[model samples]
Target: MGNNFKMIAKTLFGFEELLAKELRNLGAGNVKEGVRNVAFEGDLGFMYKANLCLRTAIKIIKPIQSFPVRNENDLYRKIYHMDWFEYLSVDTTFAIDATVKSDNFSHSLYVSQKTKDAIVDKFRDTDGKRPNVDVKHPDLRINVHIHKETCNVSLDSSGSSLHHRGYRISTNIAPINEVLAAGLLLLSGWDGQCDFLDPMCGSGTMLTEAAMIACNIPANINRKGFAFEKWTDFDEALYEKIIAASLKKTREFHHMIIGMDKAPSAIRKAQENIDNANLTDYITLKRANFFKTTKETEGPLHMVFNPPYGERLDRSDLDSDFDVEEFYANIGDTLKQEYPGTNAWFITSNLHALKFVGLRPSRKIKVFNSHLESRLVKYEMYEGSKKAKFQKS
Candidate 1:
């Protein structure tokens, strides 16, 4: 109970509940879900923990002020009167990031410009100097979010997208996003109980995330830094303590995690990334066509992968005749014929090609892969045969 404040953890579409659950598990109070975001209550130490451990969150923002605004002038007037000295100094570089969902504020860029102007003007009049604006790298990143008539201004606690986990030194052309990979694993009910596989694991994102989940490691443990570290009130000793505590909670994972790719280059990149994450001990990578492989492990298997979506794969990968339909059909054939007792899930935006997989998905969850509207489809290969599936279905 040390100066608790409300904060918003933003995420991809359809991940609000997951983020909310993560917050509650992390001891956040008053947890609530919103569209693509979750609001919760926590103090500064908890903020550090959230940034370090939240697997589904992209960015967390701490709201500093809120008010009603009709036009840009109202925004400027309101922003100018705030006591900026508390959070920012004349020597500190800052940036404004604005998102508007209102008819009053037509363009977000305009809103950002106006807010920057107000803040700089305030400093110029008061202290006879102004902080410079740095978009790429800034000491203080301000966030302005407007919905209808109310404007909410906040501090961006996570600078870049938390998906930059600092371990991906090399990647394939169609590398899956780290945050999306982690969320997909969570949604697939992958709790690291059984053996895990990513058959078409291009850059081994799913494999790495699976190992982290299995080991109970912090999601961003490999991440270099968070924005809060640059804040004026950042406590270095407290952050170190939090890191040590999180690492202490990590438990031993007994199950195997595997990644397979057809391309040699992909295997090489995945090996580099896994090594960078210090997960080479927990993950195994092989260069093999997934359709040619069978279930090599015993017991139930958890499989999640991002297959070639017909768009982003390397040119060499798609240089052949590359029949999209037959490619997916082979996927179904292999899964149905080879792998059993596996809860196999994969995401794709190519709906037309997805239908060619033949087998109907047991669960289809709508999601977004960056800008593409995608579906994370699950096809459960029963340990038993047609009788068991028919009864369950």
Candidate 2:
């Protein structure tokens, strides 16, 4: 408890609450939610555990300093004055990623360059040598964020994005981001309680994440490394102990996890990824068109998927006279007629196509896939007419 320090976990839009709840469950203190980010308090071992176990975090940052900056010079001065030796040695390499939302700092790239120069110059003056900047694989990654007149400098504890879970050796054309998939599953209330399905399971990301969550597996168990491993004060034994403890919490999952894709290539890729995650025992993959299939499970089903948005995989391409409107309508029809007692959710950037589905979404969450703003919509299908309320309200 005495070794607690502040950390911020960055996430995609609309996932702040999910990330905050995850932090609290992980035994973090001072948990607070912000826009697309969550702040919390934990010790060094907890930091390692967070990096390894957090499913929705893109990166974890440990803020070292915060101050008001009027201009670029103030930024450089404040950054240069920090105790750089505490985080990095002259022999180590580092990188700076800067974001500017203030009128005083216009170009983020230029600010990063300036900050790098200040740190290198300070180190050179004191130690006669400076750490090299390695943007690709740095020993220490620093983040500088300036909003309005306030500036916060933090050390990025997760060098690469946590989504590079290392298990995905193969991917299809429209492979979903792992963080996005995990967040979507969490948002859909998927706890391995019932059978799970991702009908359009490109690369099998959703299926793998679902299995991991069901079994209480650490999110990054397949990941090779984390930035904290390169820190000056990294404790290898502590990390090993944390891993053992996390693994000990793993539970047995009785429900089935399945994925289906119309394309055989996608099925192969998904299988390879699932095998890589060592989740082959928990998940089953098949090649079938989702629109033509009926629910195979007997109990309530939880379905989450990302269908073609027509921007990339155009349904119109398959049939020149294809009515995308009718296709989405068929999707709604199939879910209503074939899959009863199910909670179906999907994401798409095309809001117009969404209306053609004919079923009112019970929940619409605004999120992004890369740069495109999209909605994660849910449609609940009841077992009988008496329970099947048509309207979202």
Candidate 3:
């Protein structure tokens, strides 16, 4: 507790609250929400746990210093004076990731160049040598952000974003990111209590994430590694302990997790990925056309998926002879006529095609699928009857 310090977890636009809640659940202190980010206080072990467990966060960064800078020279001087030897040395290879949202600094690349020059010069003056810059795989990844006149320097603890969750080595076209998949399930209020299904499951990302959430498994438990592993102060024993403790906290999931897709290729890929994650026992995969099938699980089925939104309003997942309008309408028909007693949720960027669904969405949330602005919608289907329970307009 005495070693706790402020850390920032960066997330997608609509996931700020979700990330904050996750931090608080993980026992973070002074949790606060920011735009596309959540700030909290935690120690080194908590930092490791957050990186391993957070499903919505893209990166966890530890701020080392902050100051006011008037120009590039000011930035260079301030960054040069920091204790570089504490994190890097003459033999270390580092990279600077710069972001400029300021009227003062026009170019992030220029800022990165100046920061790099200052560090190299400081090292050369002291030891007559400097570390080389490795952009692809760096020993130390420094974050430089300039907003208005304030400059904040941080260390990137999670490399290559938390979305690279080491599972789903096989992916379909534009497969949902692991982080986004987990966020969607969480947003839909899925808690492993009921049977879960991804009707249009692609590459089994949603299925894998759902299984993990259901069983209390860590989000990045399968990740190859994090940037913190390369830091000079990394503690292997402590990290092992954190992992062991997290695994021990995992609860048993008795409910079923199912994944279905029309494409046999998709089913094969999903199964392979699921097996890779050691979740084969927890998830069931099959090749079935969702529109042609009815719910097999009894009692309180939960569904979350992303239907085809078409490629830039051009090619869609439907057959060339089939129309996109009919594709979306079928999704509505299946939910209203077949999947009763379920909370059906899906995301799509095609707002115009959504009108063809006919049924009114119980909830519509604004979110982003990659860069495209989209909506995550919910439609409730009660158990009494098909047409009567699922309200159709």
RMSD of each: 2.0, 2.1, 1.4
lDDT of 1 by residue, 1-393 (tens): 869999999999998989999999999999999998999999999999999999999999999999999999999999999999999999999999999999888999999999999999999999999999999989999999999999999999999999998899998776788999999999999998999999988877889999999998999999988999999999999999999999999999898999999889889988998999999999988889999999999999999999865565655767577788888989988888888888899999888887788787889999999888998999988876651452211
lDDT per residue for candidate 2 within 1-393, as digits (tens), equals: 788999999999988999999999999999999998999999999999999999999999999999999988988898889899898888999999999999888899998999999999999999999999999999999999999999999999998899999999998766789999999999999998899988889889999999999999999999999998999999999999999999999999998898999889889988999999999999999999888999899888999998754565545445677676787887788888788889999988878888888888889998898777988999988887834677422
Model 3 residue 166 CA deviation in Å: 0.3
Q: Point out the higher-scoring one by TM-score: 1 or 2.
A: 1
Top candidate (lDDT): 3
Question: Where in model 3 is the C-alpha error above 4 Å?
Answer: 312-318, 389-391
**Poorly placed runs, candidate 1 (over 4 Å):** 312-317, 387-393
Residue pairs clashing in model 3 are none
The lDDT for every candidate, in the order shown, is: 0.91, 0.90, 0.92
> lDDT of model 1 at residue 6?
92
What's model 3's overall lDDT? 0.92
lDDT of 2 at 141: 93
Number of the top-ranking candidate, with TM-score as the measure: 3
Q: Give the lDDT ranking, best first.
A: 3, 1, 2
TM-score, each model?
0.96, 0.95, 0.97
